[model samples]
Target: MSQADHRSPQDHEHTVHYDGPSGGWGSLRGIARIFGKEWATPAALETLARQNKPKGFMCVSCSWAKPADYHTFEFCENGAKATLWELTTLRCTPDFFAQHTVVELLTWNDYDLEQQGRLTHPLRYDPESDKYQPCSWEEAFHAIGAELRRLDPTSVIFYSSGRASLETSYLYALFARAYGNNNLPDSSNMCHETTSVALKKVIGAGVGTVVFDDLKNCDAMFFFGQNTGSNSPRFLHPLQDAAKRGVPIVTFNPVREKGLIAFTNPQNPAEMLTGSETPISTQYHQVRLGGDIAVMLGICKHVFAADDAAKAEGKRVLDVPFIEQHTQGFGDFEAKVRGTSWSEIEAKSGLSQGAIERAAEIYVKADRVIGVYGMGLTQHVHGFENVAMFVNMLLLKGNIGRDGTGISPVRGHSNVQGQRTVGISEKPELVPLDKIAEQFGFDPPRDKGMNTVEACEGILSGKVKAFFGLGGNFVRAIPEREAMERAWRKMDLTVQIATKLNRSHLVNGRTAYLLPCRGRTEQDMQASGPQAVSMEDTFSCIQGSIGLRKPASEHLKSEVDIVASLAEATLPPNPRLKWREWVDNYALIRDLIAQTYPDEFHDFNERMFTPGGFYRGNAARERIWKTTSGKAEFTVPDTLDAAGFDDAPGRYRLLTMRSNDQFNTTIYGFSDRLRGIEGTRQVLLMNPDDIAKAGLQEGQMVSLISDAQDGIHREAGPLKVTPFSLPAGCVGSYYPEMNPLMPLSHHDQQSKTPAAKSIAVRLKI
Candidate 1:
């Protein structure tokens, strides 16, 4: 029987509607609910007004760029929700912590724990009392510093979140290096690291080539493994406009998402009132999970076939001229495409040859094509190969250096791009070691550092002694959560600089400190009056953001202030580097960044005042290939069929996904209105055929066992099975909840990113 047939009113808090256009009154209702849950109408309205403004704070949601031309209401529903959540007046004080023990809090799910509210002050974990008690900021810092000094620098790991501003990120790297450590891991390491690794090899740049304006004018756009409506709602505006302008959008994902199919702009009053929706994807191809590489190859094969046909007719359809001048490896790449059998492509991609041809026809007909992908493409075992395949497809048409053509990876986190720009990478290549030593008067380490996955392994292996996090739930976000948490307990000290309490805070070491800091919604008054921090968007636009709302608590410190103070306590006085000056005047930090990266960030402080901020120059954007070959080079893909990895009996492929109600590790609410799930985050989305084959009923609860080669125990669930429209042999589950099923050692070889999108599993009914 179908899940719906057995589902009772008590089984779900709300009915699950399978069909509806995304982003209409439904989005408005969701926004209203956020305000109701977190803030009063006045506070919500005030916070919404300030979001994404040039003079105000940037939204803490996704890192999609703001338009060059500013709109009054630029924020999306989730953006508004994030602003409300951050600016909420509710506080979780020392008394709240005193009422709960770490062991008791560990039993609470992620949402319930964070929903308690914003942390008001610094706290230290007391092992004797089994609870967190209030502690002074100075004492907290001194204690952390003492521990840092007690251990070897190589034993300490510095982890950064994308929410950190450019100023704070720069300071963080500087502090880590000066204090004699090079182990820097950031949010990028877990999400877009594959993009960085793949793109830099082909284009000599780790970031996307196109700016936000490129989307408005692009002739055709291809979305691979990305749900634009849920992950980046603000990005849908340009897409909606593109559709209205008659541009064809092609989407390739496992599930047919409502956002990609059609969207009614909440910003448009007429559309919202009349219920008129803009159809987004002209052609939607539901490729199976981990099938992106095969699908990309199939499309390229069709493009080649068209090129040969056009040549036979004495006409050039492909950009041969541009390709000859700006790209390399066309001959070998074309040969491979020709050699790739249509049957293999169809079998691997789970799409018919006709469908692939149809999408290819749309791509070939357009003068300029833009490729956009997200974690869905980059969170696989062959993720680096997957991204390289995308770049290869773009290079075939000479799409990298044009008005409306380039590769754009939809990066997560508001400042994830900025974090990398300001040198939060485990592999810091942008700024040379000699130059950094010369500029900052300190010898920076040249060796590559540990990534998120490697950092986890380091801790478990006893190589890492101390762990420090700046604004992310590191323990909860990574895979093999239980093992990582157990390893974390072995640390000499753990420090978390955060705005709110999360699962990471509860996963304590012998000595742990929760240094509550001011969120982006709160005003940061440094020694030099009010300050503004700059962040780089996915499109490489750097803009200033200053908070206007009052501080959540008087005891809370700004990120910049906290980092500066930590540096003061940890490192001996370095006359050459004035931590206080940079902390007090954020402009000074930008000036230093300009000094460190003169070519791209020249006149950085002055550029902040520009209307939408300046675009950091991209070599590929101008058709100047900075690669070793002096041209974009096509690389071969590792696997045409990701399903080949499942060679064992009773194995099924699983994809970990974010619910519409969640952003990254933060669960906003239980209901995923877009996906039609309500009041539960533990449901497993599966195909009915798969459910039947496994001898499981549609609504039956089931446990998932990982097919990890390491022989480690990794499992999750008692997850409610909701038979959906996934491809046979594939299942979907929410992330962070399903994170335990991911093995620490199972990651992309090139990038060290956990293969969160593709896990081999077996159903246990």
Candidate 2:
């Protein structure tokens, strides 16, 4: 465990180190720094102790689930940081906004804006004053309601972030429908929409089939496109344990992240003292950007070929019984896999045939396999296909319903899956409008609403008159910054329910309101006597969370209260669903949710308190496929070609990534400690040959220009080029900052998730 040479805050030098393992004494040092100074130790320790604990506040950083019987001190480095970030003592009061105008704040970076700290009260933008002033909850709600009522309900967009609790999200969705529209676009649309879209078509379930226990017992785990060590650090403990138990962990990613190579358990005293780290990734394949489908196809091709040869020698390699009994379209899928040539796979995937063959051999040898992936697999042009192909490969051996095998889309957001489960969606298929209408006594809107991309278009085109964000930095999170800013300016009304000030708050609409909400770690004192909210983990375990700390501010409202009050003020009176009652109890919200999704969330509150919460049973997990075909199906796209990056010479496939120090739009620091990047966030990782081919030198100032069809060439840079170990023709840049280069039109055809990974760009040196 080499020590990270972190320079003073004054240093602005671009430092890049090639080798460093994640989560050793390095993580411990980070934990000490975060909890020691800024957060002042005591409060930070209390919050950290509560995170992910049974009947405690859940960490809203990532959705990785801990097993029912978990270790006592269960948290990762990033988890600790997230806890401190939320539980910070700093306050962003009305005086803070008064000190800096919106225009002035816009000039500040995302980190600087958020570091101003927790919003102290609800505020309404006063154009005359040119500043945010404290506004009473009633006055703000009434004003927003009046504005919303003036606009067509269909013209309003309600966006939900994954941070909201299931209880809050259910009320949010109910509020949207009761207010006369179902235009609910959420954070999921940006990240895991492909997982939902693809899995539903293939396995009849939109989410993963495996639980935390399944992962622990899996013989082999295939991590595709997910950097678990950075994104979900606690997952490293399981991977290390699996390695210790002789279970092979295979990884396929374009960048060679040190987190995937080796991990030192910060929780273990012996490992930390001895500087011993567990080596993960028995096999690492640097598959090219947007080439996941081809690589998966190549692996399947090997499996089929190996099975044929083994059968010829009087041996069985494939699960023929499972394939015959529980799956459909295998013949067609097998034929297509066999048809793809090794040359095409080698060229497209940037992986030699031997690597893919070896991965397939590992897959074949394992009795029970778990497939895990993150945004890297789901943020591409072929994102849906990438997800489906993994399912197709797993279904070959009937891995769906078993002790340790199933699909796992490791979500980055804590309650992203929970948000969707409670009905935060733009599409109508997931929302049972009839049930909602009947249960709530209103004719819910039946039309499909705008997704995140479409919402931007709607706002820009003057179709969406009002945009309400129930927690998210929409401007920073979305692509086309200028266009989104312009669109936001065009909206008649904009409302953001947030914990702190972000770039989205600074980018105001014609009439903007910033409604401050309590952070996930804060206590909620409701009429029902200190209410507790529930959040479903990525594994669909709905666990209860009760905040142990005081509210950031006395004026801060629960998201449920904000949404309920806003709904009451906006919509016409409806007696059947008493908004106040729902807000007061929350258990009533669960009851309503049960009414809406009876089959899955039946006896809602009753089953919620059970030891580790209840798992929403997936039909696919039980090998009872609920698809139209009544069996698990293999669906292949027309072609697995990744064709955009080759439009011209010097064009490279750019993947937008988050620094280890950051979590989604929120920038924690300029340095990415594990990556050896210090004192800067403007560094771009590129291949050495690609840099030379583009006539660019290391640390050269460069602009990344995207190939645009709308006449406006999108570009973001003046970024320092840093050559690193990456596949040829592929480059990496930090996201949110690089989001401008990603066009709004560039998205998955099926899921409409912005193609954040496969951008074709040329360097402007």
Candidate 3:
């Protein structure tokens, strides 16, 4: 074994993470309560409600479940009460805010903070009144417009939250540009921007290549760094279907989540009656943090060897015909794989040759296979390279845009992809921008601006003057909380177009405004009629969505209206820009979108009604890729030098993650039900041997400080130690809480996603 192998198991002797929280002495009891908590599974019912029942409302969180499966009482544990809290007949009117100061309200926890109920009108923070005073929409827009006009265009940043509908997102971008700024710092910039940056560059498509139907046809499936059971429960049905059909599901993650192993289909009445759950992954690999790329490389190497062996035997090999016709750079990629040493592969991946070979056998035996990966695959230092490795494996078997064998980058938000499709990007291509400019009759600024992180950084430096958001808690989502808060204070105007209140509304710029927008579950009626917006699923299939619930407040306007009013208030009068008419009709937006990208959006209205959804960007259909050479290119990552991080004194690797109930930076209380964690996000998960080696007993409190060469120090304070079965030496903790420990600089070189998996830290007592 290589020397790198020597330190990991020994390191494991020191730390580990759990699927749930367990406390000192009372862990058994705490765990039992969680298991017995009777948190009824409502995902199946909720999904069913959206379709068969025709409620038109959809959960803003997950996407795998069919809308027809939605139920009226249906609510997942995470979905429950909170949805009511946001969508209920509750109200937080201007009068309510008249009693509370902005400073006074800051003391409330997020749940307690927003459970104060929903906003009923437009509000502006009044320092004089020491409270948020109700303001007229026109009044607020003018105040914000004046503030925006006073600043350099580059000084203004525009952010889009994922859950915002396509209509809203398009207007948000339009107004930001008409207001003269392109700093589109959005939710994608935080969550799966890595996937977009990686996959688009790798396979010529930014979104996942597979559709929902693709799941049923795959011969072999991989669950890479994804916990489908809780994070996306609707996927449990497909996983069960795939597993029962005898297709193997292989998983590689730091922890062994039960959902990946066996999942009870809340949809399967017989299975629920018998307490029988279908098993997903035939095999699971607990890859150490930062170890996925190596595991992937090893898989690619095995595929290379398998193809060679089949060639020697003169047998019809795994997708050789597909590879030859559809993919490029296979020869160079194969050579690179062949040159990789077995010793290095096993040592770096923390896997045995036996395990890798077993996986390789499974892959080779399958004719049609799909690889499903999550943040775990894309949130690393070499994230793009990691994605390339995944694509390389598919190309070896020719799995591009096929029935089942394709790449699925499991998305975290319901409509993050849709936001991008409808022009929410900071960097709009010249072609699209030119068309938009022609329609609006304004010379659109073509500056490539800052993303989310860069926006925070720019704001901190006072380069950013104002921030306008369609929806989202910006200060909470961006990394380095301290820097983000500090930067936000410098903004001249901060606007939040949202459904409910979040901490970010409180991240007050010099002048702040909150304009509530209708949600996915709320009705949107415009002059044209009741309008429905479309969202792209993880499968790259675009489908339409309409809402059924009444607006939380009668005053709430659709996101389209908010953008149109803002644009009118900001831009000089131009007959070319018909703001009122555009907001009144969404079909015009679709027409403009189709005009901007005829290749992708041609006859956009014709396809929007198809409940089956529309196919996007058909590189697979033509077997012609749009990469550098019009073919998928083979990329070889330089060997990463571990000596710099490992040789340091008193240092270990730290990985930041999330609990199932939580979404993004929104902390849904302090319990990780699936992993059995409760009461705190401050615990450090470690292996048994690592506990002893660190001279730390289970539940011991310790601080963690970073020792990276990059000159950033990470603080993991007062972490409670718990032992779990994870591979040794790597430590795990939940995110946002863990964000401070991962420096903004420690990101994927290509995608700029924080190498959230491979942070180095010094344990403290």
lDDT tens per residue, model 2, 104-187:
888898888888789988899987877898889889989998998888889988998889999889888888887777789899
lDDT string for model 3 (62-124, tens) is: 544333334343334444323433454556788878787877777775655655566789998
Off by over 4 Å in 1: 1-17, 642-644
The Cα local distance difference test for each model comes to 0.84, 0.84, 0.69
Worst 10-residue lDDT window for candidate 1 reads: 1-10
**TM-score for all predictions?**
0.97, 0.96, 0.90
For candidate 1, write residues 1-765 as lDDT tens digits.
123222221223222344667888888888889788875448668768867877777889999876657677889878877888887767889999999999999999888888888999899999999999999998998998888889999889999999999999999988998887678888988899989888988888888999877887789999998988789988888888898899999888887677887789877889988989877888887788878888889989888888889999898767888788878888888888889898989888888899789888988889899999999888888888889999998887888888899999998899998888877877756556787899888888877788898889899999999999999989989988888888889999999998888999998888999999998877888888988888888899888888878888899999988988988999988798898888888889898888888887899888875666788888889887788999888887657864337545788888888877889899889878887888898888877767777787767888998887678878899999887767767889898898899887768888888888889888877
Better of 2 and 3 by TM-score: 2
Q: Which stretches of candidate 3 lie over 4 Å from their true place?
A: 1-48, 51-55, 65-82, 128-130, 316-321, 640-649, 709-714
Q: In model 2, what is the error at residue 731, expressed in angstroms?
A: 0.8
Ranking by lDDT: 1, 2, 3
